[model samples]
Target: MTTILVTGGTGTLGRLVTERLRADGHEVRVLSRHSWPYAVDLREGTGLAAAVAGVDTVVHCATNPRGGDEQAARHLIEAARRAGVRHLVYISIVGVDQVPLGYYRTKLTVERLIEESGLGWTVLRTTQFHDLVLQVLQGSAKLPVMLLPAGVADQPIEAAEVATYLAELATRAPAGRVPDMGGPEVRTFPELAGAYLRASGRRRPLLNVRLAGKTYHSFRAGGHLTPERAVGKVTFEQFLTGRFPARG
Candidate 1:
């Protein structure tokens, strides 16, 4: 079995991926600022060489959504190369190319670095996670009347499924930029808000607020999903019901 190292392995997605890989009987190691129960951290590249000493592949899950992800990703890539890692699998988000948002731009720059490195690599682009939707609910549900975008289309996927896909990618040969993965159904922001309210048994009314901005425009134009390539098993309703299950 090949030795696999996961960056940011303590985070949501990375933790799931690490567990799945270990379950598959591979030698899985995690790199993070804080060492997990099963892995180590390669924070300053000081011990990265030792961490990846005999690793066959590196799964890059470390990312800064705000900015500066490009530099961080480049550093991780360089460390993997130095350690003689054979394959690198990068976990990215969908529509990173079309969005032009700060986070997307950083992800795009990192993708470029991987491409230029000439190492065996694969980029798995997944849509927004359901956790993000939960964040919106918990954060914005406090408002008197929640205002949501009129036409923002999103096809969010589950973090567990995304992690599984990434682990499978790490096991296979590098396929370059693979098909995008998203949820089964395409939904608008208003629809998601309503679903959240219903699931949570909240009586607050939702207002369909028409937002005017480049970001809103991009979202409304289907820049957040892969229409043809949307392939995920979990539906939004299923996710909601599972989280806030109806009492008997």
Candidate 2:
């Protein structure tokens, strides 16, 4: 069985990826800051050598949205090289280069670092996760009125679907920078919010606000969408139903 190391294996995507890898009869090592023996902070990167030792593939799912992604990636690259890692699989956003947000910019920077790290690498750019969209809606629903960006749309793919694909990629030869993947449908902010409200049986006044900023403008322009490669089978409605089933 191939030996694989998954960083941030405790997170949403990483957890699923780890499960898929293990199910395929591969030896999977989970790297996290809290775990013993394999615990190592990617940003600090102090003890990463031990975690990466004898690892054939390293799936980088650890990311810091607030900051420090570049530093973490550099340290991980060095450790992977030292451990003789054959494949470095990375998950990135679809419009990382096109979006003007700071987080997106950082993701783009990490992608560049991996490409030039001199190691075999595979980077898959995908649209937003359904979980993130649901989180945004849940946060907005806290207030009496839900405020959303006007005209913004998201093709929310299931996290499990992405995880399975990552596991499949890890078991093969490294394919650098694969084609973008997206969900089945591109639903607008209004539609997504309405769906969440209906599914959760929550009532709130909805207001679509046109915010000023290059980032929001880019989102409005669908910079983060991949309609051409909509290969995902699960729809947002189906996801909601799974989360909140109807009473018989």
Give candidate 2 misplaced runs (Cα > 4 Å).
246-248
Q: Of the candidates shown, which would achieve the greatest TM-score relative to the real structure?
A: 2
lDDT per residue for candidate 1 within 1-248, as digits (tens), equals 88998988888899999999999999998888777443443334556667777889999997656565676666677777887888999988888888868888788888989988978999888889998877886677899988777878788788999999899999999889888888877887778887888888887777787877787788788887897876888878788888888720
* CA lDDT scores, all candidates in order: 0.82, 0.93
Quote the lDDT for 199 in model 2: 90
Candidate 1: the clashing residue pairs are none
Q: Which number leads on lDDT?
A: 2
The sequence of per-residue lDDT tens digits that candidate 2 reaches over residues 29-58 is 998888777888889998899899999999
lDDT for model 1 comes to 0.82
Predicted candidate 1: what Cα RMSD to the true structure?
2.0
lDDT comparing candidate 2 with the true structure = 0.93
